[model samples]
Target: MWRRRTLPAVVALLGVSGLGLITVGVTADPARPPRPPVDAPTRTHPAPDLAPLPRAAPVRVQIPAIGVRAEVVPVGADAAGVLEVPPLDRPTLAGWYRHGVSPGETGNAVVVGHVDSPAGPAVFFDLGRLRAGQEIQITRADARVTTFTVDGVRSYPKEHFPTTLVYGPSDIAGLRLITCGGRFDAGTGNYVDNIVVFATRTA
Candidate 1:
């Protein structure tokens, strides 16, 4: 969980999340999706212009503590800020959360990853094992890499996610990870809990 005694200078960042888990369906639901948390931070840069990252496949993902080393890819969002996840063709591995908040200027940045897919597993399968003070490295489009340190991990019921804690405000550069968890509700086809990991930029 993230705690900010006060808000600090913000920075460039975005939120990533998978949609609520669901059972394989023979039909589609027509209702609009839920609104993202209103407290999410927003990026103010003009050049990126909310453009999509090149479709180039990711080369690697690094976590110094739990031995996570995998490739990643760029996911985009609609006007609402809800982002897309991995496997553009498959719904299981995809995650999107635009309203949660961006890493406003120079504080904690939030991104959500997926745990598994109906086909098998996904990017954040081991997220539950992450601890405080670990390292996270992301290689960006320019080939420049960014590093962050894990502070802690927390799980919350989706219905009771800590809006203030996840998107409220912060005084330092950080990261928050989210994925589905808890009892599987076969009825609605969703997890009751959301795993959240807090990370901080180190370099």
Candidate 2:
């Protein structure tokens, strides 16, 4: 079980300050995703701006570039309003925020997974290695596949996590894959940073 704590920044993102936070408890040092090198070349492409699809829960996520194809389970906030995560024992599963827009919808759909577990690197362990132009395919409960193109990958410290940018409403359908990264803080038993992949729906 992950040790729960109040993510004040998250609460702020929800416009409900001090209400609740999200899960933040990684026990051991796992492999962290590489940060984007400042000198690395970047690509620029016109927004695909695909029309949003009807609401449908995401059941699976596949990233061929990173060799990720994991089951996605819905996760909602607890009674105290704290956002929940996938079962700690099920590190290969990804957790989708049920309250938010589903993938292919006209909003930011957020998904999170464990970078690694006690056993070894888990789902999303190679999230940082993904580059622009790659594709992410999400299978929705409606039996439709929603495709998204990688826009960018970024890493941020937990303290300065961009809650709004990751979870905020948007005109275009967007996807954010989040996982813990950076140095593990022995004091808190948590990763010091978060790796976020920003992608926009293409089909």
Candidate 1 ranges beyond 4 A from true positions:
1-18, 21-60, 74-83, 88-105
Residue pairs clashing, model 2: 7-21
The lDDT, on a scale of 0 to 1, for candidate 1 is: 0.48
Clashes of 2: 1
Q: Each model's TM-score, in the order given?
A: 0.60, 0.83
lDDT of candidate 2 over 131-164, digit per residue (tens): 9989999999999998988888887766666677
Candidate lDDT scores, in order, read: 0.48, 0.74
Best model per TM-score: 2
